[model samples]
Target: MGYVLRVRMASFFAGAATASCIGLSVLYKDYKTPHESISLQAKAFHDSLDTRISTLESLRQSEAPQLPQTTTD
Candidate 1:
């Protein structure tokens, strides 16, 4: 009788662990963005940053003040 009880308890624990694993896997899939989506998002962000940086550089160059050089005779 004791051996049978032990076996049943072990079986119950095993089932619970399996269920937990499956639940976690499903939740992870649902909550996490796919790698491809993340990659595309990051690429778009960097592209926008690049465009802003280029515009700023061009504006800086256009607005730069020219200094006159004095020649000593």
Candidate 2:
């Protein structure tokens, strides 16, 4: 009876260790970030280009001169 109890305990601990390892592997895979990092970099580049185009358009509008008014008395 004592030998049977010891064998049971060993099997229980081994199963627990295997479960813990599987849980850790799943957590590590879920928390990975490579694709998110690349997406953020691309978004930043697009925003910079948009700002540059807006600034150029604003400067052009400001530099253009207005035509003089003609007299029709």
Candidate 3:
């Protein structure tokens, strides 16, 4: 059998954020341009996407109907 790799997107995004913290720290410490503004835009975009994904999940759950369970003797 060949090698197989399985990746979870949530984990990937979380790893990206963790890695970015180190780089962002350095940039923030010495940033003198409009980097903060650009960063804010990027963060806002990410936040919106995360919120939408969560909202969709909640809506899906609420919309799905549950059937009554029948007990068998």
Best by lDDT: 1
lDDT per residue (tens digit) for residues 1-73 in model 3: 1222234666778899999998899787777457777888999999999999999999999999998999999
Clashes of each: 0, 0, 0
Q: Which pairs clash (backbone N, Cα, C closer than 3 Å) in model 3?
A: none
Q: Candidate 3, overall lDDT?
A: 0.85
Candidate 2 C-alpha lDDT tens digits along 1-73: 9999999999999999999999999887766676677789999999999999999999999999988999999
lDDT of each: 0.94, 0.92, 0.85
Which regions of candidate 1 are displaced past 4 Å?
A: 34-43, 63-65
For model 1, residues 26-62, the per-residue Cα lDDT tens digits are 9888767686689899999999999999999999999
Each prediction's TM-score against the native?
0.61, 0.48, 0.46
Error of model 1, residue 20, in angstroms:
1.2
